[model samples]
Target: MTLLICAFAAIIATVKWYKDAPEGNMKLGILCWMYWGASIMWLVDAIFEYAELKAEYFTPAPADMLNDAFLGLAVVALGLIIWLVWLLIKDPRGVVKAALIRKKA
Candidate 1:
């Protein structure tokens, strides 16, 4: 479940990044990299767990699935938060700079 969610997020971010490939302003590429990295990490984890659990891996408990879902959501939310903080620090549109200047006026 976590793998599925992360894979979906990575695909969406990749597509969005491709669409705005010409524009380098928002730094969306970084977000794409983060999500893709997470997806790959989860994929590796799934593979190792499957190897250990074999066929039983297919049938996880409902509670476990719920927990995985929550974790996936949390992971996605954390990625977004990090991206937002980075964007604010970068201030691609100069909004932060303008606000600071206004405060000085």
Candidate 2:
């Protein structure tokens, strides 16, 4: 479930980044890398768990499935939050700088 969620996010981010390739924004690329890395991590986790559980891995308990879904959503939200903070710090478009300068007047 985590792999699925992160893969989806990575795909979306990659597409968005590609569309804005001319802008050469680092934030978008970072977001894509983060999600893709997470997806790969989850994939490896899933593989090892599958090896341990064998056939049983296919039938996860409903509660476990729900928990995994919530965890996946939380991770995605956290990634977005981190990206927002980075964007604010970078102030790529200078909105924050402009606001601060205006306040000095």
Candidate 3:
């Protein structure tokens, strides 16, 4: 089924991101994985929406599909919040600070 294909695609994409993420930026790698998961979720949701639209032109009940999309967005938002909160609370000496310090004149 299409959903199965989508699931496989998502898993492959996530693995690819994990492999390709920059070595020095672990935070960035986590963020990338979060975003990649979200993107794949939305991509699957879009495919569902398109299929529903084509099958039933007048009434495309895409609520389930939209829910998946929102779930993806929520996951990404939650991951970002966790990362930012960690920076504020745990890792005060963040990577951004070092980058900024280097750029200072």
Candidate 4:
């Protein structure tokens, strides 16, 4: 479930990054990297668990599945938060700077 969720996010982020390739001002590339990295990590974890559990690996308990879903959502949310913080700090279009200057005036 974790792998599935992350792979979806990675795909979506990658596509968005490609579409925005010309301008490249949103710092979306960072988001793509983060999602891909998470997907790879989950893939590796699934592989090791499968090797250990063999046939039983497919049958996860209901509670475990729920936990994995929550964790995946949390990870996606964290990635977005980080990206937003980066965008605010960079102020690529000078929006934040302009707002601050206006407030001072």
Question: Of the candidates shown, which would achieve the greatest TM-score relative to the real structure?
Answer: 4
lDDT tens per residue, model 2, 17-77: 9998978655787799899999998899999999999999989999998898888899999
The local distance difference test score of model 2 is: 0.88
Candidate 4 global CA lDDT score: 0.90
* Model 3 ranges with Cα > 4 A deviation: 1-26, 55-77, 88-105
TM-score of candidate 3 versus the correct structure, residues matched by position: 0.40
| Candidate 3 local distance difference test against the native | 0.56
- Candidate 4 on 3-103: residue-level lDDT in tens? 88888988999999999888879989889999999899889999999999998889999999999989888888999999999999999999999988866
Model 2: colliding residue pairs: none
In candidate 1, how many clashes are counted?
A: 0
| Local accuracy of candidate 1 as per-residue lDDT tens digits, 1-92 | 98888889888988888888787688788788998998888889999999999999989999999999999988889998999999999999
Clashes of each: 0, 0, 0, 0
lDDT of each: 0.89, 0.88, 0.56, 0.90
TM-scores of the candidates in the order shown: 0.91, 0.91, 0.40, 0.92
TM-score: the better of candidates 3 and 4:
4
Relative to the unseen true structure, what is the Cα RMSD of model 1? 1.8
Which 10 consecutive residues of model 4 have the lowest summed lDDT? 96-105
